[model samples]
Target: MLADTATIVARLTEFLGPDSVVADPVQMGSYLNEPRKRFHEKAAAVALPRSVAEVQALTRFAFEHGVALIPQGGNTGLVGAQVPLRGDEVIVSLARINALREIDAAAGHMTVEAGMILEEAHRIAEAEGAMFPLWIASQGSARIGGVLSSNAGGVNVLAYGNARELCLGVEAVLADGRLYKGLNALKKDNTGYDLKDLLIGAEGTLGIITAATLKIFPLPAVYETAIVNLASPEAALELFYTMRERAGMRLNAFELVPLIGLDMQMRHGMLDKDPTAGPSPWYALIEISQPKGAKGGLLQAGLEAAFEAQLIDNAVVAESLADRTRMWAFREQMSEVQSREGASIKHDVSVPIAAIPRLIAEGSEAAEALVAGIRAVPFGHMGDGNIHFNFSQPVGADGKTFMAGAQPVHDAVYEVVLRLGGSVSAEHGIGQLKTALLKQVKDPVALEMMRAIKQALDPRGILNPGKMLD
Candidate 1:
C-alpha cells in the first residue's frame, strides 16, 4: 500500500530535519509551479536535502515505506517531469545541495553538484578561461541536474552536441538508496555498459542524478553574429548549407525566425528597436565563434557568398557588442512573445535536415486547416532541423476556448512529423505530457528495452513515479 500525505511529510522531516521539509501547501508554490503551468497536482511535501547522505537517507525511508519520490531541480522544466504527477508524492528538491566538487580547466572538464544553476556553472568555467557551450533560454533558473536529465539541446547544438554529449560522467542515487559514483574525467573508457548515458535522459525514471562531470572548452576570442533576410524556409535551408560549408565547425548557431515573430515582439514592446535589416517572410540568425589567433569576418564572408548565390537579398551583421546582444534577444524571445498575442499551442519536434521545409509547409497547412486564422509561428534551431512549431489563436478569440481544442492541433502536427521520419520531441524529454504519445509512436522493441532497463535500476518504481514510461 502507498503512504498517505501526513506519513510522507513526517517521514521526510524525521529523515532530514524540520527545516528541510515544507508540509504547508501554501509555502510549496515554488516547488509545484512549473514553467508551463500545466500540471496542477500538489505534492505531499517538499524535501530539501543539503547533502548526498541526506538524499540517500530520505530515499531509503521512502523506498521502505513504498512512498513515491519525484526528483526536482530549479523547477524550470517545460513538461511535467520535475513536478508531481500523483498528488501524494513527495518532491525531493536539489536546490540546497549545490557545490563545485572539482575543476580541471586545462584538461577541459569540471565536476559540479546537480543543484548548481547552469548560469553559475558557465561563470565558474569562464573564470578559469574555459566555457561550457550549452546555451538555452532557461539557463538562468535551470539546474545542471534537470538539464542533463532532459538531455537539453540548445542553439549551439549545430557545433557543440547536446547535454548527453557534454557530460563525461554522473553520480546518481538509485531507488534502493545505493549511490552510483560514476564521476570521471577520462576521454575514452571502454566499459561494459554505458550506464552514464542511460541515466542522463531517463527523466528520473531510473535514478536521481546528484552531480555531473561536464566537458568545457577554451574561451572563444570573439563571436560573429547576424540576422539575415530569407524568402522562405527553402531559402533558409540553402543559406544554412552554404554557411556550414564555409564556416565548418566554427558555426555555432543557425536559428530560424518568422516575420510574424518580429511584428509581435515589436507590438508587445519586447524589443527597443528592430534587429533585422528589413522585413522579409523569414529570417535566419547565424553565428560563428572565433578562437584565439583566428581572424574574424567569417560570418560576413559567408553572408556575401549567400547573397551572390541569390539565397539571401539583404543582411545586417553585428558591428558591436550591443548589436550581437540585441540580435540574440530577438531569437531567444520567440516563445515569450507568443503568450502576449494570446493562447498558443507549442511543439518541440525535429526532422531530418533536408525535410524541414516540408515539415513547416505541411504542418502549418494542417494546423491552419483545422483552426482558421491560426497564425503558424514555426522557428528554432534550423541548423539541427528542430523547429518550435507553434500556433497562436485567431485574433480576438477566447483563449480558454482555443486551448480546449488543442488535441486536434497537436495530432495534426505530430502526423506531419512522423510522416517525414522526424521526432515528436527534440530538445524536451518525454515527461508526463507525452507518455501516451511515446507509447503510441515509439517502436515496440525499443519500448520493451526501455522498460527492462527502468525495472532493473528502479525495481520499486519509487524514483519519479509515472514519468517517461508511464
Candidate 2:
C-alpha cells in the first residue's frame, strides 16, 4: 500500500533532517523546472541527500515502501531524465551531496561526488594540471551524475570521447538499496559484465549514480582554430577527410554551421560582429590541439593545403585568443539563436561520417517539402557525424501552431536519419520525450533485452518509473 504524502514526508524528515526534506510545492520549484519546459509533472516532495550514505538510505526507504524515487542532479538535462514523470514520485536531488573526494594527478584520475557541477570538475582538473573534457553548454549547472546518465557528448568528442569514455567507473545505489562499489582508477578490469557501462547511460532507470572515478588528461598547450568556408556539405566532407588524414586524433573539433546561423546571430545582435570570412553557403569550425612542446600552426598549414586543392573557398585562422573565442561562440550559439527566429523543431541525430552530407541534404529537403517556408538549420559535430538538425517555423507563423505541427516534421527528418544508418538520438538520450520513438525505432530484440534488464534490476519499478521505457 502507498503511504500518504504526510506520512512519507514525516518518515523522510525523521531519517534525513527536516532541512533536507522539502514538502512544500512552491519550494520544490527549482527541482521541478527542467531545461526544456516540456515535462510539467509535479513531484510529491524533493529530498536533498547530503551524502552517499544519505542517498543509499533514501533509496532503501523508497525501495521498501514501494515509493517511486526519481534521481535528479543539477536539473539541466535537455531531456527530462533528471525530472519526474509520475506526479506521485519523489525527486532525490543530489545537489547537497556535492564533494570532490580525491584527485590523483599522477594516476590521471579523479573521484567526484555525483552532485559536483561539470564546470567545477573542469576547474579541479585544471588546478591539477589536467583536464576533464566532457563539455556541454549547460556545464555551469549540469552535474556529474546527470552528465554520466545522459553520456553527454560535446564539441571535443572527436578527441576525448563522450562521458562514458571519460568515466573510469561509478559507485551507484542499486534498486534494492545495495551499494555497487565500482569506482576505481585502474585502466584495465576484465569483469564478468560491463556493469559500469550499463549504469552510466541507463538514465537512472537501472541505478542511481552517487560518485564516479573519471579519467583526466594533460592540458593541451594551445589549440589551432580556424573557420573555413565551404561550398556545400560535400566540400566540408572532403575537407574533414583531409584534416583527419593530417591531424588524426589531434583534430579535436570539426563543427558545421550554415549561413543562416550567422545571419540569425547578427540580426538578433547575439554576436558583436560577424566572425566569418565574408559570405559563404556553409562554414566548418575546425580545431586541433597542440600538446606541450609541440609545434603550432598545424591547422593553418592544413587549410593552406585545402585552399591549394580548391577544396575550400576561403578560410580565417584565429590570430589571437579573442578570435578563437569568437569562432567557438559562433558555433556554440547555434541552438540559442534559433529561438530568435521562431518556433523550432530540433533533432539531435548522427550518421556515418561519410553519410553526413546525404543526411543533411535529404533531411533538409524533406522538412522543407513538409512545411512550406520552414528554415532548415542543420549543424553540429561533423567529425563525430552528429548533426543538430533543427527547423525554424516559417516567417510570421504563430509559435504554438508551428510547434503543434512538429510531429510530421520530426517524422520526416527521422526517416532520413534512419535511412542514413544514423541514431535517432546522438548526444541526448531517450527521456520521457522520446520513449515512444525509442520503442518504435529500436530493434525488438534490443527492446526486449532492455526490458529484461530493467525488470531484473528494478523489479519493483520504484526507480524512475516511467522513463526510457514507456
Candidate 3:
C-alpha cells in the first residue's frame, strides 16, 4: 500500500527532524528549477540529508514505500537529470553534505563528499599544489556528484578526459539502502567488474553517489593562451593536428567559435572589447600548459607554422592575465548569450575527429533548408569532435511556434550525426530530455544491457523512475 503524503512527511520529520525536511512548495523552488527551465514537475518533498547514514535511511524508507527518489546535486545540470520526473517523487538534495574527507598531494588523490562544489574542489587541490581539471561554466554552483553523474566534459577534455576518467572510485547507496563502499586511491584494481564506472554516469538510476576518490595532477607552472583566426572547420582541423603533433599532452584546450558569437557578445555588451586577433569567418582558442622547468612559446611557434602553411589567417597571444580572462570569458559565455537572442534549438553531439568538418557543414545546411532565415551557431570542443550545434530561430518568429517545430529540426541534425557515427549526447546524459532519442539511436544489444543493469539494481523501479531508461 502507498503511504499517505502526510504520514510520509511525519515519519521523515521524525527520523531526520523538521529542519531537514522541506515541505513548503515555495522553499523547494531551488531544487525544482533546473538550469534549462524545461522540466516543471513539483517534488513531493525536498530532503536534505546531512550524512551518509541519513541518505541510506531515506533510501530505505523510499524503497519500502515504492516512492520514486531523485538524487540532486547543485541543481546545475543542463539536462533534467537532477530534477523530479514524476510529481510524486521525493528529491534528495546533497548540498548540505558538503565536506572534504581527505587530500594527499603526494599520493595524487583526494576524497570528497559528493555535495562539495566543483570550484571548491579546485581551490582545495590548488592549495595543496595539485589540480582537479574538470571544469564547466556552472562550476561555481555545480557539485561533484552531479558532475560525475553527468560525466561532464569541458575544454580540457582534449588533455585530461571527462569526469569518469578522472574519478578513481565512488561510494554510493544502492537502491535497497545498502552502502557500496568502493572508494580507494589505488591505480590498479582488477578484482571484478567496475561498479564505480557504472554508477558514475548512470544519473542516479542505479545508485546514489555520496562520495568519491578523484585523481589529481601536479599544477602546471603557466598557461600559453591564444585566439587564432581560421577560415573554416577544415582549416581548424589541420591546425589542431599540427598543434597535437608538436605539443602532445601539453596542448590542453582547443575550442571553436563562429563569427556570430562575437557579434552577439558585442551587441549585448557582454565583452568589453573584441578578444580575437581580427575579423575572420571563425576563431580557435588554443592553450598549452607549461610544466615546471619546461619551455614556453610552443603555442606561438605552432601559430607561426600554421601561418606559414596558410592554415590560419592570423592570431593574438594573450600577454597578461586580464587578456587571458577576456579570451576565456568569450568561450564560456556561449550558451548563456543564446537566451538573450530568443528561442534556440541546441544539440550536444560528437562525431569522429575526421568527420567533424562534414558534420558541421551538412548539419548546418540541413537546418537552414528546414527553416528559412534560421541562423546556425555551431561551436565547441573541436579537438574532441563534440560540437554544440545550436540554431537560433528566424528573426521575429514566436518562441513557442518555433519550438513547436523542433521535431523536424532535431531529426535533420540527428540523422546527420548518426550517419557520421556520432553520439546523440556527447557530454550531457539522457535525462528526461533525450531518453526517446537514445532509444531510437542506441544499439539494440547495448540497450538490452542497460535495461538489465537497471532491473538488477532497482527491481522496484523506484530510483529516478522514468529517467534515462524510459
Candidate 4:
C-alpha cells in the first residue's frame, strides 16, 4: 500500500505544517547529498521535525500510510543510511530537534538531543571543564544521532571507546511512533535487554534515535604527540604494543599513514608543511594524554624503549602546539588528499590487532597484483586494527576506468580480511554500501538473529526499509 509522492507530501504538510515539508527536489539537496556522492535517489520529500513529539507523530503517519521514512541527522554519514535508497522514501531530517536537556560533568554524563551537532556537544562538555571524546572528521556538521547510529570510531577510540561505550542510554521513536524512553545516565544498570545498545548502532533501521545520555570525561592537562617513521605495518604493530603497555589508558591515538598519503597531501598543498621526518616507507602518529596533576613525557620515555628494541628509527616529536596540530593534520588529511590523486578504492575493514600486519601486507599485495602500478595507501587506527585500506589509481589511469574495476579489488581485500578473522566493516556500519557484502561474509546464524530483531522491532518495515538486513 505505497502512497503516491504528492499524497505523502500533502499529508506530511497537513500535520507537520507546510513550512516543515520540502516538496521540491532542488531544495532537498542538503538532505540527499551524503558524504560520498554515491547514493543519489531523490527522496519523495524532506520532513524537518522540530521536536521529539513531532518525530513520533511523523513516524506514526508514515507507518499508517505505508510510506518509508529515512531518519537523517546532519547528512554527514559516509554510508547511505541517512539518505534515501528508493525515490519513494521520505527523508526525515532530525536537525531541528537539537537540544541540551541536562549536563552533569561531575556525574560524567550529559543528555542531548540527536540533532545537536557533534562539535557543539564537545563545546558543552568543555564549558563544564569536561570532555566528550567522540571525534570524527565530520564533527563540524555530523549530528549526535548520526554519530551514535553509526557507532562512529574516531582517532581517540583507543582511550575513550566508540559511540556504543560512550553512550549511557537513548530515547527513541519506534516504527509505530511509540517512544522508548531509555535515556537514563546510570553507570550500571543491568535490568533487562540492552535496547540502548541495539538502537545506537542500528543505522536507523531499528528505530529513530531522538536523544541520548552520552558519557563525558575530565579534560586532560596536556597531550604529547609524535610522528615516527616505521619500516612496515609489522613494526608499527610492535610499536603499538609497546605504547599500550607503557601509556595504558593515556595512549589516546595511534594512527598509521603510508608514504603515498604524505606525497598526495604535499602534491595537493593540503598541509602548510610536512609533519613527519622526511622519506619514510611508513609512519606512525602517536599521542598520549597527560591528566591534571600528572607528569608528562611518558610518550618520549616509551619511544626510547621502542628504539632500544629496534622498533622505530627516525621520529619527530611535536615541539609545540602548532607542531602537534600539524602532526594530526597529516593523519586526518589521509581521506581528503586521496581525492586529489584520482579515483580510489576504499575499505574500512578491521582485523584482530595481531593480524593487522598480515592483513595490510597481503591486501596490498593482492591489489597490486590486480591492477599494475596501483598506489596502495593503507592507513588508520593502528592500535584498534581498523585500517582505512585504500588504493589510488595507477598514475595517469582514468579515474572512471579505475573505479570500474573496483569490485575485484574489494573482493581481494575482503578475502584477506575475512581469512585473517577480520570484519568487513569496523567502525562504519553496513548501510546500502556494504549490505550485499555483509550477506556473503557474515555468519548465517548472526544474520538470522539480526533479521529477527529488525522484524520484531519494525514489523511494517517502514523505518529505513531495504537497509541493513536487506
**lDDT top scorer:** 1
- Report every candidate's CA lDDT: 0.93, 0.91, 0.92, 0.92
Clash number for candidate 2: 0
TM-score of candidate 1 to 2 decimals:
0.99
User: Per-residue lDDT for 109 in model 4?
Assistant: 95
Residue 218 lDDT (model 3): 92
Global fold similarity of model 3 (TM-score): 0.99
Ranking by lDDT: 1, 3, 4, 2
Worst 10 residues of 3 by lDDT: 1-10
lDDT tens digits, residue span 43-66, model 1: 889999999999899888878888
Task: Write one digit per residue (lDDT tens) for candidate 2, span 98-172.
Answer: 799999877899999999999999999999999998878889999999999999999999999999999999999
Misplaced by over 4 Å in model 1 are none
Locate the minimum summed-lDDT window of 10 residues in model 4.
1-10
Candidate 2: list runs displaced more than 4 Å.
none
TM, every model: 0.99, 0.99, 0.99, 0.99
What is the model-wide C-alpha lDDT for candidate 3? 0.92
Backbone clashes in candidate 1 total 0
